[model samples]
Target: MSAAPELRRNSLDLPEAVEAARAQYAARRPRSAALHAGALEVLAGGNTRTVIAYEPFPAAMVRGEDCRLWDLDDHAYLDLCGEYTAGLFGHSEPRIHDALHAVLRRGINFASVGPGEEKLARLICGRFPSIERVRFTNSGTEANLMALTAARAFTGRAKIMAFRGGYHGGVLTFPITGASLATLPLPFVMADYNDNDSAAAVARANAADLAVILVEPMQGSGGCIPARPDFLATLRALADETGAVLIFDEVMTSRHSAGGVQARLGITPDMTTLGKYIAGGMSFGAFGGRADIMALFGGKLPHAGTFNNNVLSMAAGGVAMGEIFTAEVAEALYQRGEALRARLNAVGAAAGVPLSFTGIGSMLTAQFRIPAPDRPYVPTPGEEQLRELFFFDMLEAGIYLARRGMVALSLPVADADLDRFVAAVADFAENRAELLRADGVTG
Candidate 1:
């Protein structure tokens, strides 16, 4: 009858511990601090990418080799962030590195259809189940934009259905805080993720005006939460009934399998947008689907980008898909990730830490939350403090995690490294027991 300890609204009283960690972090990275100070003169808030920035200044990584990174302060860390899931092949993948060199020797930008484009396109079309025909783009943001455009053109509808906490790209974010002003100016009906009835109701309400229902098979930026099979099935059925385009934004989840999450889930969307490691760690993006819808792009609605088919991305992407990340290797990597996640969860259970990791395959995000038997998972208030404390603690232990507590595995990460990371988490739970326990976190 009493309030659940984990659900009580108590202030996270860890200022002293947090300050100590911050002090240690600052003392270890004076050079990085100075770099950020100087960068403030030019770059906005000493940051070009918003996600990489953190308080007490972000560590300036000097170089990376395989699964390791060294900061300007000479601190070495196992690169668990994996460039936020984009560094799947790791920093120094030999094949992709050599392929980029070959591309440079041949030409930087031919400004015309290059030989590698077809090769890369062929590989993508073959690997992704939904991509019957594909087109290149400079980034995933552009790819999503193009896919939505194609949908609106084909369906002649102006509205889009997106989920709260879903991040398609910089301009396509739909956080629980609400869509930002920078988000593309379109009529977007927001729905809760993994809530089938909410999604179905939203789709029904907008069935007449819905152009596309855009979703991530696993919501990457929304804490790596995988969609329930029934939820995806509901969307598929809704799209079928309404004749709206269903687009899966697999920019991060595509690395889950050779055929991506769509193939694994036994669901095929009308379109798929891809990026991240598909280009072998190079900058790249792609969108493709039923040939009938895509045919409208060049003929009915003009689509062009100067670097759409750049030689470097095309060549590296081709080698990445065809030579390195074959179906067999992808399956093996996925199995490794599944095992690692299980181990991590086991460690959390043993330590009595209220830690939950949500993800599939090589992608994951750690969250601090109270378990609810009758409701969906919702993060606890002041959980960010726990996350930041964990981040600094993990860094001190020589594991580089995202500030937001995301950890992604790369092909080059060894089993020993994963074991070490798990050990580090256990150590964190022990060391921060008082603070965590006071916050009502329990196994």
Candidate 2:
């Protein structure tokens, strides 16, 4: 007997699936929709941060406690995004709260230099191996900008070497071809990330004019791809050979280890830019390195910001680094992240799907692809649709993550929460097995 009419392996149309998901998301977040509508009257596209904006609008989170976030519609989710790695301490950490409270009670801002700034600077210099004379900025963007300025001033060169897909803040993003429209116009030499020969060629081509070779130890926004150690070492050697300053954009990767990615890789960049959780969830950024280079601001070049040494950020950052994120604590967190990623990968393998996670330490990006032996690192075309579907699915499962499938583990994230997230991922893979299989995704 012939099999009753062959069944369709992938019956779901991607467009239709996306539409249905958007509709479901909208239906579940009426309050968020209303808020977005209200915000449109004031903010452009009803959003200020482009990264957080998504189709059919985004959720308006109301409050967060520990690793949980409550959105406008009162939906609670495990905050795996971790405020894009800014909330490493998570929301409402008792220590951070108490520290900020004390700051508020004593003073909010002081026009003059304060003891808090010096204390925080000392703490940072001690923790980060490369930093010797740290200077604070209001945001990572500011910190990166200042770092580049220092590099240019020191080298007396105008050209910079940056990698494609490396983000150095809002104004310093370099995509595949050129800098983003909003990025500051600079003489940039773009090179392929993690490609040693490409980077060396670029650096050598502009050696005379190369002021700084800026890079992230791990590309946080570029799918959380970590740079190969050999590649970083090559960049280091190139910087030395060309007399170009090397700047490590450790704003995101700093959370990975006590001494940051540079320390982990045993490659000391001339300068390191920091931000995110360094201020204990407050507004913060810092750039510092070799004493001679950082000394530019002392007399040679002027760097000033009204809030550069804001009392609250300095106090919170000092406590967070000195007390909360000690070496032992960071090591434990890194180990936990390693265990979680291994389990997540195992889940994908058992499902026989070409799903993989890329990242180092407490950060990861879940990627879906059609299996191709020759192009293993290449993502499948239109795989973003699958990622969007996964985002909606995970959100529905009470797990929240970056729409791009990025996750940053917070200190408050419990072992049970990680297990739950992995289980959720397994469910997604199994439930969508037919679609994945039809997409040529294989073991």
Q: How do the residues 102-201 of candidate 2 rate in per-residue lDDT, one tens digit apiece?
A: 9899877669999889999999899888898999999999999999999999999999999888888888887654548988888988888888889988
Query: In each prediction, how many residue pairs overlap at the backbone (N, C-alpha, C within less than 3 A)?
Result: 1, 0
The candidate 2 region of ten consecutive residues with least summed lDDT is: 1-10
* lDDT tens digits by residue: candidate 1, 260-349: 989999999999999988899888999999999999976898988999998889889989999999999999888998888788777766
Quality of model 1 by C-alpha lDDT: 0.85
How does each model score on TM-score? 0.95, 0.95
- Model 2 spans with C-alpha error above 4 angstroms: 1-10, 370-381, 440-443
Q: In model 1, how many backbone clashes occur?
A: 1
lDDT of each: 0.85, 0.85
RMSD (Å) per prediction:
4.8, 4.2
* Model 1, C-alpha of 94: deviation from truth (Å): 1.3
